[model samples]
Target: MKKHLTFLILLILTAATGYGQSATSDADSKIVTFRFQPGKDMFVLKGNETELTRLYSLVDEYHGRITAGELPIRVDGYCASRATEKANLHTAYLRANRVKSELITQKGLKEGDFVTANYATAYNGDKDVVVVTLRIPVKKETAVVKEEPKTETRTETKPEPQPTVKEQPAAPVTEPVTETVPETPAPVRPYHFAVRTNVLYDAMLLPTLGVEWRINTDLGVKLDGSLAWWGGEHGKTMKVWLLNPEVRWYLLHDKRFYAGVSGSYGEYNIYKYMVGNILSKDTGYQGSLWSAGLTVGYQLYLSRSFSVDFNLGLGYVRSEYDSFGMTNGVRVYKDRDKTKNFWGPTQVGINLIWTIGGHK
Candidate 1:
């Protein structure tokens, strides 16, 4: 009976230890979002000494749990909305990667045991912040134990010299205990398509249209076109057509800064301009210009779907022109065909953009 009591006590203690560990793990699994400096990559922990301490402690505990249980952990990284979508996505990945690096290098965590994901601005709405979370897999098992019932054997003095009948075999012990662990839910998908428009074209008085296809978080392509036509008395007329296409690359995590290469073809005819600053009465120049250049730009996002883009392009322009003499808007003669070349600013624009087809 004493042995049974001791065994019961040991079992109770073991169960209590397991429960305590489970509770500790739960406490350490909180979702933590850390702040960073605006437009910078450094974490901001000032006045958060307690939180910082707790964060490190939680990481250590997580590492210990995984090591002890040999269980896998999933660590998800997230960043809040920033100046650009690309920056947000990249920043989130970097933040999560940084944490993973620390755990592996400082806490002796195995890299393969962790799954890291970047949720970009989808998880957090705050600016310049990063969130990290840990998840453990659930497992179920069963254990069977047989407990012998306490028996007080009484000695019979009746010299029953007959072969002592062996005590009836103890009833077959059969007990099954089952334990099940809760399962973790799967993560949400993060990738999507987005379309954007540049409003600056409308303000130019020359109606323009643009389409942008964002290939991913770091790269995108845009195609734009602008057109204008005007006519007045004395054979004066002006017409312009421009087609511009560019490919952009986001260089920073916040995606506020970008560089692009653009190619443009422009055709114009200005019968309104004559020699010596006079209004054209019969002569004008018709020309086509082709330019290829590089541009650097910046974007400031006002909201999840709205932003302003500023771009400037500098490159070489090759222009070919022919002089046409017109009489009352009728071409009568042509002369002075020539070609001119120069290297300078080719484009300047400020655009208000609306992003569509992407998650808010």
Candidate 2:
């Protein structure tokens, strides 16, 4: 009994050693691994590269071997946990597909040569990797058949008739019903034209008219003109004409506050009625001024179609003046001519605005 037990133990040890050696050899020969950086669209071949070359070289060598042996291949893809399982699955699928595409296109492999699978946050334990494996076909063992001598025996039995039950009818079928859905309306854009009058200038009877064209919610341009003429007995006469054009950029989408620049050109005439208490007909100085300025302002919307705008301007003005006197209502030019240059507040406006075609 002792001799038989010792022989059985030796046989078991030998078998275990042989199985371990076989498993190690199979692991070394069958599997090749490469690591990948997480959250990247492209695969890096150098992740498990050797010095001065890449594991990509090993892939090429394996490709040649596969082509020679006509072996099947598999690509397994994995991704770390994403916000949702579907996202992880999709990412892993995309990575596997990308690898398969590169293998077919760049490595000159046939599209039919590879199959892909996405592990999806599994197998890698929360790390991202793509594994390319060459599949080894399993060999099936042949079964041995044992032959035996044939003998025959026969027995006779009588057939009997059986009664059958009738089948019941199925229930009536109903069509599926679909629910109606309401349609959504399209969005409206805010664009329009507004006409505004400067009421402050109206106090001076200097009717000022402004037209603003708002191309968008936050950008606009305005053109304004003011004209007035006054004449009295003692040769007291004044005439003024002004043209101002400005570009406005609203700071808010609602167009509450804005800053812009303007260019203005104006001409005015001031006449003195009497020269030394005697009516000299018309003695006056006519001057023309041009200015360019920076402006800042705010608008208070009173209603859907009405608003008030208050703006201030400061800039440099250049003016040229010519003196003249009139005899028999005809103008006569004087020898005195002057030019002036000054910089200060150039404009103040309080305007009442009415929107014509703009949105609220």
Whole-model lDDT for model 2 versus the true structure? 0.69
lDDT of 2 by residue, 248-287 (tens): 9887533578998998999987676222113243457788
Prediction 1 global C-alpha lDDT: 0.65
- Please provide, for model 1 over 95-155, each residue's C-alpha lDDT reduced to its tens digit, 9 standing for 90 to 100: 6665555445334455675767766555545665555555544343446555555544556
How many clashing residue pairs, candidate 1? Answer: 4
Q: Which candidate is the best by TM-score?
A: 1
Off by over 4 Å in 2: 1-191, 272-284, 323-335
By summed lDDT, the worst window of 10 consecutive residues in model 1 runs over: 182-191
lDDT of 2 at 351: 96
